[model samples]
Target: MATKPRMHLALDFSWTQVETDWRQPTSWVNRFYPDIGLFEDVARICERGLFDLIFFGDSTGIPNTWEGRIDAAVRRGVAWPRMDMSPWITAMSRVTSHVGFGLTYASTFMHPYYTARLLNALDHVTNGRIAFNVITSQRKADFQNYGYDELVEHGERYDRMEEFVDVCKKLWASVDPDAFVWDPVSGIVADPAKVRPINHVGRFFKVKGPLSVPPSPQGRPVLVQAGGSPRGVRASARFVDHVFGAGKGLALMAEQRVKLDEALRAEGRDPQQVGILWATKVIVAETEAEALRLKERLIADVPMEAVGAWLSHNTGFDMSTLPPRFSLRALNQRIVAANASPVGFVGLLAEQYGEDMEISRDEFFRHGLHAATGYASTKAGTPVQIADYLEEMFEATGSRGGFMLGHSQAGHRAVLQNITTMLVPALQRRGRMRTAYEGRTLRENLAAS
Candidate 1:
């Protein structure tokens, strides 16, 4: 009999329990935002479910785009008080063995050498279970924090990102993977011939010499990138081992797959070897009605001010200045003119509701409420039903990659528990998920059939 096709699964903790979900009755984030134990417990749960990775997406600045002030974001905890997460990931690593940790850093604002070295150390710390998610910071707030008066030009940012990864790759290869030779009698720590300097000079940066750290366990951390734009997609194809994609819908997902495949082939890389893990939000419960009821909590009690702050922050537009009514196409043009991301919430909205369609300000906020709370895209159902949706999406999107489930309602212990204890078991029973980890390293596991 032919082997049954299986899909890889990962848990995205980036904003799962954030955005007012912390205030929910079932959420423990209110009491455990910075608690090491909370993350440790999460890691343990993911490991138990045989999850491929636990991802963290980050930003370095507070939201000030809503009304040109930070009051709303700070007061409502829109995206403030964020920790570095490296140390937190380290703590989580100690409590789990097989699950991978994905750490994000902005290549536009950060130096390549430092990022390469930090990820190398983390790879060793995680025992080869580290993936590097490199991004180009597009938020005005993020740029300001990094000493920039404005956001980097869109195409240039990706240019810098491609060069940034190129430099890191060279630095990682500076010291040969087999360079270390711990000879007790000879008293030699490493082979002198194997260590070399990488004299790199490029459009974005210039660096000299070898990285100080030893070669990492996986040779280098698995390279991951999430770039939804055309330029961004091309950049991802240049170097990413796997992609972090948006799960807007089946048609869009399949379209993205085709685009990525074309870009990969242009880069002389095998498209089949690369995978795109679509960012998916799922809420699992004992019954469909119960799950739908829980999904309602995503928008419950979330104030309009907070919604505006979130939408403005993410789209890099001032929602406070929105006209009484406007078309999605016009709004997207304004966002693009301001050099903000052209394909975020606004782009998704344009795709869902016709770009030419004009919407009232009140209607916009109604959509904003759902988008801000992640209620619009979240799938709620019993384990069997949720698994069915995933299976369909998997098959529809070429079946090479799988889903990164989180960013909606997984913040509560009950919701997350339902995923591990219920949803995962359902997938396993259908022979669509792994029962045990078959690889020692994350890269190996992701590549496994």
Candidate 2:
């Protein structure tokens, strides 16, 4: 008998609007504070709905990488100057009962020691309701901000991540769970026996062991990373518990999922352990037409120039440098990678686009691959429509789950309303997903049947 699938919602909220509009910081995202209004509403709603974790995505680099202008990046509201998501997530932890928070930051650029200490502190602050979305920083311009001559090549960047993640793991392990025990009778806040120095030496990093903070809830916050290149698969295979991706169709994404798992085991890691999650967007309404109308309005509201900037920064190529026809067969492999053997970098150009290699790269860009719009008809009509599509997605990919929702207006609130009121109940009727959280921490939720 087939066991039912478990669905977990991960939010990329806060600075969630990657829309290439909204020039001012005030316009970027309303109420950056997590303890206050919208975020609070979002938290309470998701908690009631029993979401596993809602991830807070923050990019160190601007969307201005393509055009070399911060102005366009700022106007579009694409990951601009932002508050550290960790502190805000701590605020959410104070309010919510279950639901963990996954905070995203770059693994490629930042020093691993700082990453370890910061994440460990968040783990303490959130009482273990935290996870890390390990990322190889995106912008070529970010390297310049940190005073580097150029962006590290793709393969080299993943190599750095391998070392960086190792260092973080060691740092997390350094402070034993039994290290801190306050007792006034004997007078010992922490045991000296528990302090283990890391003294780790690697090609990219060197850290003396033992993090200062002790374990709080989960042994170590769950490690999460998004799908990038094939080298990304190898990196994720070794470290990520959940891998996030976005695409236009479930079938296309399912194909990607298979490739990811194969890459995982090829790297000698158990592919089954790593969950392949599709990064997606689903705008729901009481009616299918209503949803379509709303989507059209949102797309129109987005400025073409802003979208152009997003495209440039993301693909890491100046649109002016290459038209639609130039085969992007080769990216700076130090950064971008080919999928499977002789596979076009599906992370950039899905294999579908490569059949006509002579097609303009610009033409290929318009195919809606970066965005996992999902569904052939572009409609998740009624509660049943959404549920049916979600189930099909799981069946197609053999994925434990698919990731939908992110930081935006009513990010969690909107999703929870849709899930609890419409989606979840619909799935429950069909015998997929869960009615409640399985555990108190993020990992527990991910593992819960």
Q: Which candidate should be chosen as best, given TM-score against the real structure? A: 1
TM-score of each: 0.98, 0.85
In candidate 1, the residue pairs with backbone N, CA or C atoms under 3 Å apart (3 or more residues apart, or in different chains) clash, namely none
Candidate 1 total steric clashes: 0
Q: RMSD to native for every prediction?
A: 1.0, 4.2
Consecutive 10-residue window with the lowest summed lDDT within model 2: 338-347
lDDT of 2 by residue, 1-449 (tens): 78776666765564543452132233323444323555666677777766777777665666555556777767655556556666667777888878778888787678888888888788777767788888776566566667865566667777888889888887888777888889989898998888889899888887886777776578887998875556777778778888877544666677678888788777787766677656555656678886665444334444545555655555555444445455545433322431112222333353555533555554544442223112222343567777777777777887565565533223323434765567667777776767777676777778765
> lDDT of all predictions, in order shown?
0.89, 0.63
The lowest-lDDT stretch of 10 consecutive residues in candidate 1 is: 15-24
The best candidate by lDDT is 1
Going through the candidates in order, what is the number of backbone clashes in each? Answer: 0, 22
lDDT score for residue 311 of model 1: 90
